[model samples]
Target chain A: MSNLFFVDKISTENIQSIENEEAHHAIKVLRLSVGELVYVSDGHGKWISGPISEISKKSLAIRIENTGETHAEKPELVVVQAFTKSDRNKEMLELVTVSGADRIIPWSSQRSISKWQSDSREKWMITVKEACKQSKRFRVPIVNNQMSTNEILNEVKTGFAIVFHESAKEKFSEISLPANLDRIYLIVGPEGGITEEELQLFSTINATVVRLGAPILRSAHAGFAAMSALQTKIGRW
Target chain B: MSNLFFVDKISTENIQSIENEEAHHAIKVLRLSVGELVYVSDGHGKWISGPISEISKKSLAIRIENTGETHAEKPELVVVQAFTKSDRNKEMLELVTVSGADRIIPWSSQRSISKWQSDSREKWMITVKEACKQSKRFRVPIVNNQMSTNEILNEVKTGFAIVFHESAKEKFSEISLPANLDRIYLIVGPEGGITEEELQLFSTINATVVRLGAPILRSAHAGFAAMSALQTKIGRW
Candidate 1:
């Protein structure tokens, strides 16, 4: 496969215009000239196959040849992670994107150290988009606004829900995954872990409490590990 | 659990002397004083419960109150990873230790960007030790000197072996683990992935070729996922 670049929008006609930023990247950073073959994804599941027609300092034009469908519309696995400190939260977002999580909900648990502000939601979206581009993912995962534990639990009632805790007895491997399961909601606590009331709420709601392992993994690492394992178990990965 | 530190050498007596770098860490970094409680490990499965008895600029003395029996011996899990660039290789080592692998062996594959040098072996050992400490592991995973792919295959004669490849037909979860299997060897290729010859060699030797999922993961991330799955499959975690 050749290098794929993501563009915000593109047309199917012979002459297609590239976004200003993408044009600068192709002409200045990648140094592509006229008639060079390149691929661009519109983040809407369409892969535009074309060649560079005009390379200007501000914008580049491409002649489209064919279009291909490159994505699926399946309901995605969303992780509702309790907010940690800045460093760990950033790492958690990176890991979740790389591990192919569909959405991330910054949650405020009883033990959360950091609180999410409405102003910072856009910044978090930018970070997640960058990670998606780096990982070559066609569809960027959604970043939801911060929610309280009760709000998240309410959302979990609509899908397959699982919570990761240290004291859980059921190994993840032994859990029976539903065959027609489409959307999965994973809840991870902060570094200090979930409070007893939170666990009780999950238990009362019949959420599957699973254990990854005995050696306690950091919050960021545990998110990735659990996502990878769940994907493998569900035959998605 | 409280913070635990590993010392290189410790006498089997009730009185223990901390010197050199550890002493500096206890005295300056953590700011522990006399009669304070601390946990120390010898990095050989032995953990000591002790309290500081004396303090000085260069030395801190501890009086051991109790010695617990060693935790269960680590199940042998060896990681054969192809050499990556410096920063990525370091992250790979950190994840390997955090995932509870017992040993790491660097491999030089056809697509490897980094070449192993004799002088860098010591630095790799230090990285592993630091990762072990940061992950709260009592024993540091052994870092073997660099070896060729052929050499590793020759040495791994009888134990269960698995290779992670994107095109493999079998999923890792489909493999039936041995009842008494104590050792497992996982081989992961570099970012460019393994060559056809290496795959052929593994196939000829009946090594299980497994795929993690449909989505392609970076090489460094593959080993950690495989180890996590294996640990769960064997009921070791």
Candidate 2:
């Protein structure tokens, strides 16, 4: 796939305009011009690929040839990641985004060592967007604000909920996911582990506790492993 | 589990010595002394949890009480990663080790961006060892010497192999693993992707070509996703 630029004009008459950073990169850095093919995305699954018809200082207009929309795949994967150290949390966010999670939730578990800043949600969204462009995904994942354990329990009780614990009796693959589940919620605890109260809360709410196997993973890496295993088991991968 | 220190002698009379950096940490940093409890591992899978019997400037000897060996898990996973840029190649090595691959092979593919130096194997092992300790895995993954594509094919002909390709028609979840399989090889290409020649080689060897779904992962991140998915499929997750 070519470097895709996001634009607002997807169904424009004959020409679509590319502006902002996308335009600057094409004209100044890549030196793209008329007659050169530039892939464009509306960031809502709509995509267009055609030759550039007009190039000015601010924008490059592309002549539309063909356009298509990519449907989101299933079963959808949502990762609820605990707040860890700053850099490690970012690493986990980037890793899961690249691994193709449908949505990401920043969770503040009892044992979490880090606290979310006032701008933490916005910063996390930026990280998700950067990962989306890097992985060339046309659709950006929905990034949620920092959530308390009670808040997450309130939301996930309606879906298939999984809490990854080292002491869980059943392995992750052994759990039988019930049907009518369009999405799976993967709960990753902090490095120190979820407190007894937190585990009790989820257990009381009927969330299945599972283990990812022998090795203990950091808070950030667990989401990648859980999402991968769940996606494969749900037959989407 | 207490903080585990590796010892060269696990089957000693009653005293097991924890020397070198492990000793320094026990005595100096952790301020551990005799009569204190400490976990010890031989790293060949033998582990003992007992009290510290002797403490010196360079070593902390432990008294063996409970002794047991950890059995290696089934369906051993192996990742053959194509060499990429230095930092990314190291990142891939660290990722797969933490994901529980039993062995790793550095592949010098036709499109490899980085050449494996003569001492690269030793450096790669260091990365693997670091990841092992970080993940708290008792079993250390075997780091193999760098191999050309031809060499990998020669060695992998006996095992079930799956080459991850974006153009593959079947998803990784679609393949049925044969029973009694001792090992599985996951071939991951460089960022530029597998050349036609390389894909043809594995295809000719009857390796199943599979996709990990829609998003394109970096060469460093693909192995973790592939290993996690395959381990789940084989009932080891």
Highest TM-score: which candidate?
Answer: 2
Each prediction's TM-score against the native? 0.87, 0.94
Candidate 2 chain A lowest-lDDT run of ten: A1-10
Error of 2 at A160 (Å): 0.9
True contacts kept of each: 0.24, 0.78
* After superposition, candidate 1 runs with Cα above 4 Å error: A8-17, A34-37, A48-54, A61-75, A117-119, B8-17, B35-37, B50-54, B61-75
Q: Candidate 2 regions off by >4 Å? A: A25-36, B25-38, B51-53
Error of 2 at A77 (Å): 2.2
- lDDT tens per residue, model 1, B81-188: 888877787777877888878888888888999778877789888887777677667767788888887887885656788899988988887878676766788999
Fnat, model 2, is 0.78
Q: What's the residue-level lDDT of A60 in candidate 2?
A: 85
Q: Record all residue pairs in model 2 with backbone atoms less than 3 Å apart, i.e. clashing.
A: none
* CAPRI class of candidate 2: high
Q: Summarize candidate 1's per-residue lDDT along A1-237 as a digit string, tens digits.
A: 344577877675677777677677777888887888776777666767778888777887778886777566455699988888877766678778777888888889998988778776887887776666666666677888898888998988888899999889888888886766677888898888888899999987889998876557777788887887776666555
